[model samples]
Target: MASSNWISGIVVCTLIASCLFVVAGIIGIVLGPHILQSQVEKQLPLTADSDQLDSWSTPPVPIYLQFWLWECVNVGEVLRGAKPYVVQRGPFTYLEHRTKTGVYFNDNYTVTYRQPISYTFVPEKSALPETTRITMVNTPIVTIVALLRNQSAKTQEIFNIVKNFFNETLFIDHTAREWIWGYEDPLLKAAKSLPIIKDLVPDDHFGYFYGSNATDDGLYTVFTGEDHINQLNNINKWNGISSLPYWRTPWGNQINGTDGSWFPPLIGKDLQSIRLYLYSTDICRSLYAKFEKHSSVLDIPTELFSIPAEIFLNSTLNPDNIAFGTTDSGVLDVSVCRQGAPIYISLPHLLYAADRYQSRLEGIEPDAPIHRTIFEVEPHTGLVLSAQKRLQINVFLQPEHFIDDFKYISEVVLPAIWINESTTIDQKSADDLNNQVLRFFTIVRWVSIVLIPIGIVIFIVTIVLFKKHRSREESTPLLFAEANNTIASDHDH
Candidate 1:
């Protein structure tokens, strides 16, 4: 009787435990995503007030800039009938201060924020000299002066007249120049005193000019005006009901989505292509950027690792050769992006352009992966954990029929230099995000997987044990009655 009672108690305990496990498993599977989403939503910056939004926002992140300068070592060689060559120089590092200035809601109730960005070169952190000179070899005015230096006095006078005409038409004097990174060579320097060239080049101070504090001078500045984010608020139609702007989806969050939405609250396995219209300080324009449809979903490690270069290459950010104004069939007019100069934008390693843009030049390794920009993003929070923003500055050089020396030069876009601005998440932030968020999800996933199977096994075992115990209990009474009857018959005999 005691053994039977103990068995009955064990079965009851097992059955109750099994039911609880099964219930927990089902709850996790069905409601886990909703619960997690709720937690994320609570942390979102939905309030219009700056202080409230700032409380939930991420702090300013540092961007480290490194410039790979290509020094024209063979300029003298070119003068001696040899093809010009360049040697790659230091990765000059600069610390860029980036921050979201403030948040406010527009008349349409769209949340908008200002990002104030500034940078200063850190000489101590760099591998190159603070003041290095690069010859302005490709500038039309400089090249024209060099070509006419040996001509007769009459030829030079005629060239001067032609140079002045071209300068006014091309806005050559007003063309943006980076004095910090480039300067005119001695040959071009002597020609600066010529009558036609006296007022062509702006004062040295003008070379350091950036636009008003909030804006940079370029064609794309129009896209990044005070009301930039408003342009991205595109209405999404769904099932005859207009949903909120594509940025704010049924998920109640903004994420890097299609052309209309370029921020993040990305969730699930939808590997759709996202478009971004970002203003480039270098190119001075707002570029139409898009990622390739097939992006690699990486399994990010807790520790820092090199990001794949293929990610940026596959993105359709770089303009195709057809983007240049070509008479060829099926060519697109990308002239709006050109600001008096042929603008060629590229990824860190010069990965995307056709033969016209010479990326595989000297100082660039044949297979150096470090030349490519790297990016590590926390998908859940939409935070950039680490990034290397690499871009090469290029100029499309075309021959001028008037200049004698230009006949020998092939029309191609020449790469001047590339810049890599890299940043990594500080240790403290990495630890907090990884330990608190990522690990929690991992633990919950594993626990749910384990509990369901264990619960089912325990429930089955409990049922089997209960059946055996009941059978034994039912047979006990029958056996006792049979024995009693046999004994009674013996007594009668």
Candidate 2:
């Protein structure tokens, strides 16, 4: 009886252990995905306590700013009614740094921040010095002329008087620094006195990227993802406004995207079908990036997204896109957004643009491999693994019927400078992602996979052992009765 009880106890213990393991396996299989997703979501929000907040405010990734300037070579011949001959210049490279300041957490699951960015010249990366001269259009003179295109003839006459006073030529020699930073001109010196030119320039000097260093873009209110994880990093408001007044249509004005720096965790969502939105404060507009191909960074699986070339197409060729003008078939008019400046934007080397515009220039080359904007995002984490935003700045040097210098100058889209701002994840961040997130996910997955099969095997063994124990007890009952009777008789005698 003692031996039977021992065997029975072992069987019961085995059955209980198998039952517990099966329950654990079922729970893991059912709830594992949710737990992992929760963990990922926790790390994404921009809360003060979160580790990712520091990465967003002060990114560890190195950002590079590269420029290729276009120089008008035959300025004398171009002034005599000939198409301008152009030459492409060096990649004047700079290392850019950014920091977020004046952080304020809002009550409605959003945080506001002011970002200041600066750039430093990198000699090893640059092809030319800051003092390298570029022969290009006299931008202030051309800008004033284009600004007065819609003004009354009386207003034009007043501007003509100012132009004569400045005596600025259509084409002039300026250093790379002057073209990139700010250069003083006589007409812009009186910009305060002239109402027409006042809004176009921030100060007496005007350069493409001159006055932007160490300046905060604006107040940005971004989602913290407390309520919904997908909404993380999305700009709820920019400069106290939910939308911009720069573009022509309502759809164009919506400020619905992240700050182009960080993306929320995607987890198990469909990446290929989803469209990523990026809001660039510099452009005062949001661009949608569509999945182009499968890519990888730091050996992490990623999806490559690019701004659709359709966005660059004009109204007629791409009728669905109403953000740009109907006439300029290949340009993005950032004039209204840029304080009434006649600033036309395009892809570097006139890439993804109308062929006619590219054909109009002598040295401009529109190659996709070299110039397209690229964003490599890790699919599961939604982190920007690597990114390159390339753009070209062009000037509309149209012939004005009223101006004598422009009479010989034909209507042409002139390329001034092209820029490429790019960044990639550092190895340390990649290693952290692997250790913290990817390793946890792997362990959870293996637990579910191993536990289910092991639980089933243990259950099958328990059932077989239970049946054998029952059979042995049933067969021994008769033999055990006879033995018990013999023992009782002996005791009576």
Candidate 3:
């Protein structure tokens, strides 16, 4: 009896433990996603008290800026109305630094800030030294002449007189550093002496990114995510304007997107669930990206999102751009926002561009694989792992009948320089993500899947043990009773 009682007690305890395990497994399976979601929710909001504050104020990753300038090889042929030929020059790489300054938290669940940006030349990364000479079309002069299409003939004549006096050619020569940074030009100064040209351009010197370094682009107001998590990092206002007046349509002017550095959490996993928009102060418009393919970086799975080539296509192929009539494919006329300089933006070498652009120029090649902009994002954390932004600048050149040297050339776009901005997540941050977020998530998922089978197996074993003990007890009942009667008779005697 004592032995039976010990066995029965052990079986009962085992049965109870099995039941508890089964219940725990079920609970874990049911609540696993919610728990993971909750963990992500705590980190999504952009607040001063939040864990991302330091990184937000100053990006932890290194950003690089590279310029591939167009050097005209056949200026003589181009001037004589032959197909304009150009060759690509150096990839002048610079380490770009950014820091948020003049930050202010607003009461309306928004934060306003100005980002001070600077760039330092990285000699090791560049293809050529800063001293390499680049000869290309005089963009500023051409731009001014283009703008004078509607000006009085006297104004055009005045511009021509100045152009002649300065001995400015259809193309100008400058060193790589002067082309990328700033170089003084007498034409820029002499043009101001003309009454009509006085207010045309405020810049006295010209470069691809002149006045870009050590400057704040604009004031940005972004949501804090305290009120709505999806709105996190979305622009609320820029420079006190709700929308831009640059474009012709309301949709084009609408300023709704993140500032390219941050994105809303939890949506990176779903390609169709949401679209990502980036509002670039430089471009003065919001551009969207579509999920392209599954990819990985730093040994982690990621989603590759790329801006479609159609985004740069002009009026004919892209209906959204129809307001600007019959423009070249892969042309985005941001000239209205860029000091009315007839500057157009495009992909490097006009990839996905119409054939006309390529036919008009020599020594230009469009490689689809090399020039597309992409963002590799880790899905679960909704963090960007690597961002590569590429864009080319072109000047809208037309025959100015009123001005000499410009009259012989047909209307075309002169390729200037393409820029690439790249950045990747640091190793330390990737490690923290694995340790703090992914590891816990993986554990919960595995535990939920594992415990169910373990609990069921133990439960079945306990049931078998219980039946066997019951059968043994029933079979031995008569023997046990007889022994009890004998003991009672002895006591009576």
Candidate 4:
């Protein structure tokens, strides 16, 4: 019975030892990866949608203006008003396909179905003369993309019909393989007019074309239907995997590195001065080339506002190879005038960030309006005029997405920075409040990290002490027995 009891105790001890080892190993293995990932995420810079401005809203223009924007406002009139003088009448007709799917008037809605432009796509091409002074272009490139995903044929037919009916048409092609005029060499010679090219073929997946005719100094951008469709469909594949929905800014940037969005209020210095000018944009380069001339007032020492950065209005600037002109076939003029200036943007960044934010929200707030403001100085006149306008997106991100976007902004795309004179205690207080919330998770993460190893050490020490105590106890009994046996032997002798 004694032997059996001893054996049972030994077994139990062995089981306990084995269990401790296993538990410790599992804890380290499971918790290590998650903790490491959290640390890595923390170290990353502010990403795409992570900034607070992602959710900021502009004051809404009245409903009457919104209707007038699409109905009566003429692009030319707006352009001329801003230009300070009227320019000659342009050649190509201008029509705004404010809707994602261009609208077409047809007899029936079935069988030979024709889907007019919806609010989904916003293409920036020269508006057709037929619709000029009547409609405004406010659609997004993606909106047009959604329209032509599976309906390429109908899109083409509509393009042809609109051209025939209006005597001139400017439609971006879903797949423009060669230049629009590349194949129709003969037609060009005989035809009296040519369509404007707004967008260029980024990839050769499929041939697509978009035409514009707004002004000579406009850009035309093109997106292949297949390429765009594939990206839209497979965007989810990029989740958690780095480097998929890549984008470039007008400044030739692979990523937009805006540390924070509390852009400094322009004062004292030339609003034209560009400091911290991203090494990517043409304007940045153009300004930098003349950096030596502005050395006196070039916000010296801090280089923040050394040179003035000029973002020209779409109508005033020449965008031949890019998008957004009516006369030129280049890039799409997705540019928007909030008050009046062109809001140069990073398309891929906007799309991915917006999409990621929207996906999480699941359609709560589905549109993000882009706003642009311009400050102009006439030579020695110091400051002349400032104008701001809005860029409307058919779909805006939800409030939740906008808030959570900081994850991407802080971690992946751009980190926050205190630029120029935009910092104050009030703003810092708000940031501090947010940081407290963020720090809670950070503290918990760190505490768990420290406790895991400490727990393991404590477990090992307890096991060692218990083993030593057991050894001492076992030896004590044997020592007592030996002493008694020795004493008894001596007595017998």
Best by TM-score: 3
lDDT of 3: 0.83
Give the best candidate by lDDT.
Answer: 3
Candidate order by TM-score, decreasing, is: 3, 2, 1, 4
Which lDDT tens digits does candidate 4 get at residues 1-493? 5864785576567556655655655565556445544443332212223232122111111111111011212334322222111121112212222111221222221011111211111223222332333221222222222233344555534434433454331112211112111123221222223232112212212111122112121111111112221111011111122121222334332222211111221223443443322222211111111122221111111112222112222323433222233311111222232111122232111222333322322212212222221222211111111111212222211111111111121111110000011111233433443363334444555655665556566657656766786687689889999999999999999
> Whole-model lDDT for model 1 versus the true structure?
0.47
Ranking by lDDT: 3, 2, 1, 4
For 103-199, candidate 1 gives per-residue lDDT tens digits of 4444543444545555677888877665655553445443344445555667666665654554422112221124333434332453455665444
User: How good is model 2 by TM-score?
Assistant: 0.84
Q: For model 3, how does the per-residue alpha-carbon lDDT over 35-84 read when each residue is reduced to its tens digit?
A: 78777877778787888788888988899999999988887777778777
Model 1 shows how many backbone clashes? 5
lDDT digits (tens) for residues 1-493 of candidate 2: 8987888888788877877777787777778867877777776777878887787888888999998889999888788778778888889998988989988888999999998989899989999998999999887878777777888878777777777777767888889988897788767778657776576455677889877888877888999888888898899998899978777788888987787666776556676777788887656678888888888888877788888787777787777567655545667777776656677788887787776676666777788877888898875567898999888888877777777578788777889999999999999989988897777767877887788778778879978978988897898888899999999999999
- What lDDT score belongs to each candidate, Candidate 1 first? 0.47, 0.81, 0.83, 0.26
Q: TM per model?
A: 0.65, 0.84, 0.91, 0.25
User: In candidate 1, how many Å is residue 357 off?
Assistant: 4.0
- Using lDDT as the yardstick, the better of models 1 and 3 is 3
Model 4: worst 10 consecutive residues (lDDT sum): 411-420
